[model samples]
Target chain A: MSQVSQATVQRVTADLYVEVQQFYARQMPLLEARKLEEFLETLTEDGSIEHRPGGWKLEGRQQLLTEMRARRGDPEQPLVEEISAREARERNVSYYDGLVYRYWFDRMHIEPVDEDTLRVRYQAIVSMTDAAGKVSFEPTTVVDDVLVRIDGELYTRSRIVTHDSPAWADKIHNPS
Target chain B: MSQVSQATVQRVTADLYVEVQQFYARQMPLLEARKLEEFLETLTEDGSIEHRPGGWKLEGRQQLLTEMRARRGDPEQPLVEEISAREARERNVSYYDGLVYRYWFDRMHIEPVDEDTLRVRYQAIVSMTDAAGKVSFEPTTVVDDVLVRIDGELYTRSRIVTHDSPAWADKIHNPS
Candidate 1:
C-alpha cells in the first residue's frame, strides 16, 4: 500500500466516522425491528459475515437473510402463544413475556484501507432486558468490518465477529 | 431559548459529535494513566460531577482531584509488594497483579442546549482485565455531559452519571 499523508488520513477518518455511525444507527434499528429487507439494504448485495471461534461464514445477501430469519424467526408470524395455566403459574410470566435484546457498539477504531474502503473495528456488547427491568449480559465480541463508499453512502462489504468466549459461538449459531 | 432550524441542528450535531469523541479519546487516556491534573485540564475550572441515585457530587477541579486521588491512590507510590510464601500459594497472584481498568462510552445522543453549549448523553461500561487475561464488568451507567467550546476547543462543564444499579453508587463513592 502506498503511504498516505497523515493530515489526509486524519481528515478522512473524522468524516468517515460520522458517516459510519449514522449508517449503523439507521441500520441496527431495522435489524432490531426485524425489518430484514430494509436491514439488508445497508449492506452490499454481495456482502458477507464471518463468525470467528466457530468458523461459520454466511456468504452473500441471500445467506445473510436466511441466517437472520432463522435466528430471529419470521416476524410476520405471531410471537405469543396461549400458555397452559400450570405453565403460566410455574414461570415468571413478566420476565419472559416482554424480553428485549439490545446491542451496543463502542470503542470504534477506524483505518483507511484505500481511498474508497475503510476498516473499522469496534467492541459490541449484547444485553437482555426483562419486563421487570432486570438486565443480563452476553459475552462481548469484537467486530471488524470492511465498509465501502457507494454513491456517497457507506455500506458494509464484509464483517468478521470474534466472540470473547467460545461458548458464545454455540449460542449465536443456534440461538435458544 | 430561540428555536434553531432543523438543518442547523443537524449540522451542529454532526460537527460536535466528532469534536466530543475526539475530546474523550484524548481525555480518557489521561484518566486511565491517573494523570489527575491533566484530566482536570480537559474540564472547566469550575466543572462538576453528579452521581445519581446516591446524590454524591464533586464540585470544582480541586474536589475532582481529591476524589480521584482517594480512589486511585497515589500513582507515585509503588504498587506491588513482595508477597509472603504462604500468601503467594493461597491467593491467585496473576489475577491481582497488573490489573487494568477500562471504560467504554458509546451510543451518544447530542442535543444543542444553546449556541455555545451541547448536552451529550452516552452509556459507559467499565471493565477490569487481570494479568491472567480474565475480564469482568462493572455496572453500566449513562452519563450526561454539558460541553462548551472555548476558542475552538471543547471542555466538559458538567457531568451527571446515573448507574443502572443503585448498588454501584457505593462502589464509586468508596472504592475497595
Candidate 2:
C-alpha cells in the first residue's frame, strides 16, 4: 500500500470531478430527449443502475437496456422514433403521449479508486412532464456512483441511489 | 496537484480501513453501554448526523447530543445510569425497560480526502433485545461518514445514514 500525498489527493479529486460532471451533463440531455440508444451507448456492457431505497438493482448492460425500454415504453404506442405523428396522437389517451423527462445533477465530491476508476457522490432531481406540460418533480435522490474510464470515455459502472425522505420509494410505486 | 502513485492509493486505503474499523469497534461498545458523554467525546465539535431516509440533518455537537438523549431516552424514567435496580423494574411497563442495543458493522470502505480526513462508507445493523431476551433487527443503514484525526484521535465529523429499504426510517418513528 502506498501513502497518498496531499498533492495527489487534490489532483485526483479535481480530475475525477471534471470527468464525472462532463459525463452527466452530456448524458442527461440524451436521457431528456428520450434517446435511449445513444444514452445506452455511453454505458459499459457491465454497467448497472440501482435504486437502493426500493432494493431495485439490475445488473449487466443487456438486462438494464431491456428493463429500461420496458419501463420507459408507452404501452399504447410503438417506440417513439418508429411511430408516426398520427399514431402518437392516437396514444394521447394513455397520458404518455409526448411525455418529457428532465433531469439535473449538482456537483459532488469525487473519490479516486484507481487511475481508471473513481466514485462520485452527487445530488440529482428528475422531473416528469406530461403531454400537457404538467411537470412534477419527485423526491431527490443522492446518487453514489462508481465511474470508470474505458477507452478514454467515462461510464457509470454502478449507481446506488438514496432518497431524502423515508418511504419515498414506496410512494413512487404505491401512490397515496 | 500531484498525481497519486498506485502504491500511495493502496497504502492510504489499507491504513484508513484498519484505523476506522478499530475506532468503530471501540466506540460501538460505548454506544451500546449508553455512555453518552464518552460517545459525545468521540465526535468532532462540529459533528453532524444526518438520517437520509428523512432528510433529518442536525449539525453541531450540542444539538446532536441533546436530540440523541431525547430520542433514546428512557421514557419511563431518567437515564439508565442514574436509576436504581428496583426503580428500573418499577418502570418496566414498556419494552424499552431493560432494552439492550447490539450493533454489528458488516463492512466499510475508506476514501481518502486528505491526510487528516477521509470518508468511510459502512453497512451496519442494530438489534434491540427486550428484557425477555427477544431480539429483533431493524433494517440496516449504509452510513457515509467523514472522519478526521484531531490530536491523534479519530472523530466523526459528519455521518449521512441511508437505510437499505424505503420505509425503514419511518418504521422507527411509527411502529407497526
Candidate 3:
C-alpha cells in the first residue's frame, strides 16, 4: 500500500507539488502578518482575486494591496497585531485579545500545465487568536487558483475563493 | 519529452484519469440532452451540486432532479429540446420553434485519489440552437467536482459550477 502510494506520488509531479506546498507554507506567515504588500508582490501584474460568499473582488496588485490593508484598518490599527517570535511559548497561551487570524491548507489538488504553470485547488481553514491568544476556528474555504512562473519566479494569476459560511473578514474581525 | 510526459501519466494513475475523462465526455451528451434522470444515476446516492456566480445549490439526487426540471418547467415545455441526433436536429432548426441548450467540456484537469476516486476540473461552454436553427452561445463556466467509484461504478459526489456570465437558462429562456 505504501509502495502504491509512493508510486502515485511519483506519477504525479511530486516536484511541483512540493514546490506549491512550500509556496503555501510561505504564504501563510505573510498573510498572518498582514504583509499585504509582500503578498501583492507574489501576484502577477494582471492578477485578480474574487471571494464569493462575501462578494469582494480585487484586480491588479496595486489595488489588491490597498484594499487588503483597508479591509484590515488604517495601517496603524490593523486587524490583528502580534509578535510571532518564539516569544516565551509559555506566555502566548491566551485566546482573547484583539484579533487572531491563521490560514492553513489541505486536500490539495494540482494540475501541472507545461512546466511553468500550475492550476491548483485546495481547502483552507481560517483560525483566529485574539490578542490574549484565545482561539476560534472558521469554516474551511474552497480555493481555486492559477500559478504562473515568470522570469524564474512564481506568481498567482487568478484566484477564486468560496467560503462555506459567510465572508471570512466578517467571521474573524467582527465576531458575534 | 514524450517519455517524460508518459512517465508523468504513469505516476498519476493514468487509468483513473482516462475513466474520469470518459465520465465527463459521457456526461456532456446526457446533460446536453437534459437527461436529468440518467444524469442523476451518475451521482452518488448522497450527492450535492452548487452553481456559483448565482449561488444555486441542490442536495440529494431526488431534490436535485426535481429542482432541475422545475427550474425549466413542466414536461411539455422543457427549456432545451433534443437535437444532437440527425433528423431531430434538422427538425429543430427554427429560432422561434423552441428553446435549445447545449453543453460542451474542454480543458479538463484531473487528479486521481487512490484507485476509485478522482477530483476533476474543467471549463465548459453552453450553446443553443433556436427553433430557426439560430445558435447563440452562453459564457464559459468553470466546473469542479469529485467522482467516486461506487459499487464498481463511478458517481459524482459533488459538483460546483461557476458561470462566467449569467445562467444559461436565463440567457436562453428569458432572453432580452
Best by lDDT: 1
lDDT of 3 by residue, B1-176 (tens): 68855654566654455445445534544554567787787788779988787466789999888766644332124234432222222343322224445455666777665677777888876544433223345567899988888655668999999888654424433243
Score residue B117 of candidate 3 by CA lDDT. 79
The per-model lDDT (C-alpha) reads 0.65, 0.59, 0.60
Per-residue alpha-carbon lDDT of model 2 for B133-172, expressed as tens digits?
2334567889998999876667899989897877654353
**Which 10 consecutive residues of model 1 chain B have the lowest summed lDDT?**
B1-10
Q: Under CAPRI classification, how is model 3 graded?
A: incorrect
lDDT tens digits, residue span A1-176, model 2: 11332223334433455566688889778766657778877778788887755456778878876655645544234323433212333443222334566765543546677889877766556565655455654555567888888888898888888654333443332111
Candidate 1: misplaced stretches above 4 Å? A1-102, A106-123, A127-176, B1-9, B13-15, B74-99, B130-134, B171-176
Whichever of 2 and 3 has more TM-score, that candidate is 2
- Candidate 3: list runs displaced more than 4 Å: A1-11, A73-97, A166-176, B1-176
Model 1, B47-146: lDDT tens per residue?
9988776557889999988767655443233333543212333443322234466778766666667777878777777665654565655566678999
How far residue B135's Cα lies from its native spot in candidate 2, in Å, is 33
Every candidate's fraction of true contacts kept comes to 0.10, 0.00, 0.00
Clashing pairs for predicted structure model 1, backbone only? none
Candidate 3 chain A, which ten residues in sequence have the lowest lDDT sum? A84-93
TM-score of chain B of each: 0.76, 0.77, 0.72
